[model samples]
Target: MRSTTYYAHGLNIKSELFFPEFPLKQTSEIDVIIRFGITNLFNDSSKNFREIYLSKFIQIKITSCNLLYLFWNDIQIFTIKNNEIIINPNTGLDLNYIKFLLFGYGFAILLYLKGRLVLHANAVDMDNSAVVISGVSGIGKSTLSFAFHQKGYKLLCDDVLSINIGKKFQIVYPSFPRIKLWPDVIKNFEEDPEMVPKIHDKTSKRFYNVSGNFSDIKKQIRAIYFIKVTGDIKIKEINPQKAMMELIKSSYCYKLLNHHEISENLSQCSAIVNKVPVKILEVKKSYESLNKLVEIVENDILKN
Candidate 1:
């Protein structure tokens, strides 16, 4: 297997897949090793798990020992065994599924298992600090980060915010330099959506390469913003209790958490809320209003 060593979320990962777009560095020591191989993941008859989450397209099981089984629609199955992940992809599976598996939710869970506070947020660097922008899907987290990129602010991470929680501070690690954008977002930038390359065939979303628009350095989080798309443009500071609830709600794969994991995750959220400035940002969804919304957020960040 061909392997490449890369740095992401402040960890040295030796992955069998050739993900060269990340900040690559050759190293003899590896913190996490990812391998592409075959396994009978569907045959979990003998294995035991304490918590289970099932849906029409996905099934996730978390063991009492903290082991995880993530199955993606029969296309792929990921079994996290310690620091190593054995990915079993069906024969002749679409390459898009592989990309989605590796980039989308794969590493998020891995980071969670590694004891980092992972959030579904996009982050940008401003004044030597990271400002995290989070919300539900389609709420324009990445689009706003892209707008910040246009203004010369460095994009720290596009999707996942792997946080290093200290006593009085929280630092968000840098991710790979790419942002996924929908057709509407491209149109808002006055760009032809048809010209952009789609990330997957099942969706209209495309990957926007932010190689030059990103920073290689991770930064301490100075603020967090939860965005709402259908309201008048405004920003409001959220209290710690409310921020904790919002953080838990916005977490990726939160439903699969066991009782212990849920408590730990909530504690982490509370810690973050206590230390960082958390706020709710309400902005109207329109091409004409995007710039004004960016300016509003910029002003808030500058003042605080």
Candidate 2:
């Protein structure tokens, strides 16, 4: 099989399978490899693995040898060892869904192993710096980030944001050039939702490719916003102490981290809060307010 190289999240990924979600890059260095293969972790008799996290739809296990196994219901099994991800899929799974999982959760795990802080957020480049918008699921993070994209601001990432914390600066790496949106959000943007590709057969969410509007370069993080649905629009900076807690809560795959990683996460979050401004943004829960929301955020960014 011919392998392809792609760049995202500050890493050169080489994979045998083609991933349209990521941008193709020409590079000799391979930071991560993705391939298809059978995973026998569940059948291993040695049983050296410990279950790290389990939910109704997914189960995560880690072996004593440092291999990570992720089983998503009956759909797929991902075995991550070192810099390689081996995927084993069950019958009748959609390739789009597989790519969705690989690009999101699988890559997130890889970033975690590489000691980067991964957040469940969307980011846009503002004045050559990155601004992150995060919240609980279905909180319009992607929609707002797309609004910024519409305003000529380049999108750094959507759904997953990775950061490298240095002594003097926190740099955020761009993810793939894709954003997921609900059907209504697409209609609000005056595009037919049915024309876009569905993220999965079971969901109405669609994937919007923003290759022309993507920022592939890494940038220093300017600020982080935690948004809420409220009656009015407001933005207020949060103190470092409280910001640290919000960062922890917004961490991707927080329950899967070990004790050492948890300690490191705490230290990194503290560092980020001390160096970067964290704020709470409250906005009305209506699509009509999107333009106003964007105006308020841009003004806030300009003022700070």
Candidate 3:
């Protein structure tokens, strides 16, 4: 059996399946253990049902047994029990599809189960502090993060930003050493989009490896920026009331959780806003605006 240890979002996971995008770590104690195996159908006898997130293609289920089950559009199922994960992909389906889901939503849900606060954002390190950038899908979170990385900031994580809250401060843990970007975004960075490896055969998005620009050290979060597209570029601190709302909105899988789960995360989100500066960054969605956008964030976030 192939096995490896990957460090992601403050967890040291030892998995039977290999995830090349994550940096290898040597640890005797593993926070999570994963294994890829044959599929098992969700038991109808299970009760205390909650649909974490449901789409036409995929749905996540939480049963009375506390098992978190992720069904991938008839192609595969990911079962998480405690710290152990079992991925059961359809025999004939492409493994790449399963792989893509596993790293993205699969890991986010697992981290939530572990009680680690996870955000759907990309973060970069600036002088040992984390600046998190979040927005709705296709708002260029990863692309802007990549731009920060090119400008000498170490990329902390992309897509899923996990934070550890403490009495005095919050720390953002480093995630995988890669970012998923669309073809046009890759082209903006002066790279051939075609040369970038596709995330899955079914999608045109590709992953950019940033091993040299990756940072494993956890940093105290300095600010959180919720980006949006606008005709003109601007950055401003968000009102506390709106910041709380943005925090709730930017959280990973917030819609899928039960009322209790939602309440718990809400408290966490409320507490986080008290410590970190939550701001809105508005900019035009064009390559010509990226440099100026980065400059504005650096001046505001790094200086404050």
lDDT of each: 0.79, 0.86, 0.83
TM-score of decoy 2: 0.95
Scored by TM-score, the top model is 2
Residue-level lDDT tens digits of model 1 in 1-304? 8888988778788888677557887889888888877766336554666544444776666665566777766554777764877776553656666667667677888888877788889999988999899998778899888888877889899887788778878878898888888888888788888987788788889887778878778799988999987569899876778898889887875776667878888888888887888999998877677788779988998898
| Candidate number with greatest lDDT | 2
Lowest summed-lDDT stretch of 10 residues in model 1?
Answer: 46-55
Higher-TM-score candidate of 1 and 2: 2
Q: List model 2 lDDT by residue over 45-95, tens digit each.
A: 557877755457767888776788887774546888759998884535677
Consecutive 10-residue window with the lowest summed lDDT within model 2: 89-98
Ranking according to TM-score, highest score first: 2, 3, 1
The lDDT of model 3 is 0.83
Better lDDT candidate (2, 3): 2
Off by over 4 Å in 2: 43-46, 74-76, 89-92
User: Which rank order by lDDT, best down to worst?
Assistant: 2, 3, 1
